[model samples]
Target: MIFQPTYLDLLLSGDLKKRAADFQRRLKACDLCPRDCGVNRVEGEIGFCGVGNQVWVNSYGLHFGEEDPLRGWQGSGTIFFSGCNLSCLYCQNAEISQKVSGSEISVEVLANVMLELENRGAHNINLVSPTHVIAQIIKAIYIAAQRGLKLPIVYNTGGYDSIHTLKMLDGIIDIYMPDMKYSEPEISGRLSGVPDYPSVNQIAVKEMFRQVGNLVMSTQGIAERGLLVRHLVLPGGLAGSKTVLEFIAKEISRNTYLNIMDQYRPAYLAGRHSEINRRITSDEYQVVVKEALRLGLNRLDKC
Candidate 1:
């Protein structure tokens, strides 16, 4: 059976075009993410993300560093967006994410990039840090789908998305890959500059799971569709992994594809904060891994 991405239905019904226009219109008083900066991006007013109406791409290519199902034999088609909504102190890709460093490209060009990745035989269209530019992506998808973009769309985000935006993206995005950064407001506030991260992240995760439940894969171990959650273990257990695991087990689902990442390192402005200014210990990583196991999350990603 040939897999047809959901965007095909939306594109055929003309809903994709309408959604693109509606979302682009939202940039006039932009409320794309949870921050609700409300800056007129179309008219060049900047907000928390530091990006305007135009879509910016730092880089786009086939990335092999992703999880098993996503990477597969052919790498995941990754489009790394420039700006980010959350202000994480220890951002690994601060050069692009923090500074919003990227070339301004039109929707047509972005659409072309998707087609190019497809031509190169990418498994999925992985949009990393896509919380801000969903409107542009939708517009590009609208264009690309008509030209035969059949790969599943991956919404890779920092987990600070709004419920309204998620509702709009319900059918467009096939795989929802978001980070569950923290479960404590104080810790989140100190580390990520978003005090409501824990609250906002949980709501966004629920919406993601609602749209696409547990991950479904092909016989070749390629991810077809679903929700894949990523939790980065911060130094000294600051991420509140227990509460996060508990929430996933109790609220989301036991069958959820959990990726408990241990690749936290001091980068960008992390040196200023002594607490998280170093790499996490081996014991720290295992503690969260053990908690996830104890919570009955059996489908943990072997990352």
Candidate 2:
């Protein structure tokens, strides 16, 4: 066996306090995510993500709705944070995404949540919508390390990320789960209110793949370390699934683990937008899956 857990080993064997302090400094003038709002979140300035310095988690529990590998038997210790960087019109979790529902937590309380999940046999600590609150998450990781949190950390994001921000999570995060929303800029702009999301997401996914390559699963099928790309097939070619598959096969690694999702339905402002007003058709999803397989990406899940 290896000497200590990989991420926890790095933390315990090094001075995490220094890392935490350095990360906290970035919050002063937060360019933490790609949004680069340049607002001082530590000074209580809310930026594009509608969040401040403190991490606002909506829920902390075992989640089985994730991919089979991620969920496994027990479940992933999922901590869903409120306020998203990308305001997708069809955001399923509109309640938590648009409004802060949980109590404001300190690094200590956040650390406890990590341990609580570990005690309950969670495979990993999954941080959902973590782009804006990366600093606090790192600080919490440092604290949790001291208290013996050994499971791998998953950086679950909406794919609008800053490369500089991801650099800080170099040795901390083991799994990078990001959504590749749209392949066309106009579609992204119209749906998520973010222009040039296709190109922006490409850069971000490249950085994630650079950090972690293809998914390396344990004997039990739990992902140990890797980059997992999730793409939700939107209605009326908004997501451009064929192009996305081609990009993964050509630009990103062909062996990259992907989830070809088919669970898209009208939500949030989807009903307001004509292009995204309808649910994804079975044929549309089939075309995307066929393209993925043709591109040699065989690893996929319906959920």
Candidate 3:
């Protein structure tokens, strides 16, 4: 293997271990995510995320469908954590995110899973929907980094993050893949059921961008560090792609990598709603993509 410093080296620096410990301590009282449920997860209390004391992972494997930079020759070491803080009406991974369909795994086992991914030639460790299991993930990262795990770590989140908790990961996560889900609060609340989501996600995404700027890649084009913003274009512009792009252009850097996705399909509870019970129109997606380009967002993902 190449002589590379473990990803944790950057993250666990400057008393980050103490921050992790303190964050873990708070989870017992459990105000981990933005919800501030305070359910005492250490005692097996399930909060808004439906995750209990232990970490429940749905699957861990090499995923090729991610952005090109993330999926080099070898795929991303994708660990799909079960349960999500927000249950969007049109959620694609409803089975795992909503139902929390996975067996509980110990931190040691989770660390081994990271090792197995590295052994299988994965380019990085990608944590999906990791809000509830941040503590366990951090602990496992500590364990894996000590045992020769040196791959970059990716924090793939839904933009619903706790500022305090994210501060603890300042140097630990190399790649930040956050979704700019909505730009309007009412739309976000109606679809994703998160009140004041625009302000919430904006603050959280700003923090992510502050920690890691634009997407940086290895000489081989694999992601090493930086930020990649994903915005899924929903039907009727309900996902608020236009406003999200504008915010990216105005608030964030214009050079930031923006992924305007067209892969929206009515799933989960979306079918139960009138405006969102169908797939997004091709015109709708084209308009948003065009808007992104007109706004000088060049780093778009076609796949």
lDDT tens readout by residue for model 1, 78-182: 999999998999999999899878799999999999999999999999999999999999999999999989999999999999999999997899999999999
Candidate that beats the other on TM-score, 1 or 2, i.e. the better one: 1
- Model 3 alpha-carbon drift over 4 Å, by segment: 1-7, 10-16
Ordered from best to worst lDDT, the candidate numbers read: 1, 2, 3
lDDT of 2 by residue, 2-104 (tens): 2234667567667566768888998888888777888898899989888887888888999999988789999999999998888888998888987777878
In model 3, the worst 10-residue window by lDDT is: 1-10
lDDT by residue for model 3 (1-303), tens: 242533555445635456567767988888778899988888888898988878998898999999898889899999999999997988998999998787789989999999999999999999999878898888888778778788888999999888888888887888889898998888888788887778978888888889888887777888887889989988887887878998998898888887888888888888889898888888998999899889998888873
- Candidate 2 local Cα displacement, residue 197, angstroms: 1.6
Best by TM-score: 1
Model 3: residue 46 alpha-carbon error in angstroms: 1.2
- The TM-score-based order of candidates, best leading, equals 1, 2, 3
Q: Note the Cα lDDT for every prediction shown.
A: 0.93, 0.85, 0.85
Total backbone collisions for each predicted model: 0, 0, 2
TM-score of each: 0.99, 0.96, 0.95
Model 2 scores worst on lDDT over the 10 consecutive residues at 1-10
lDDT score for candidate 3 against the true structure: 0.85
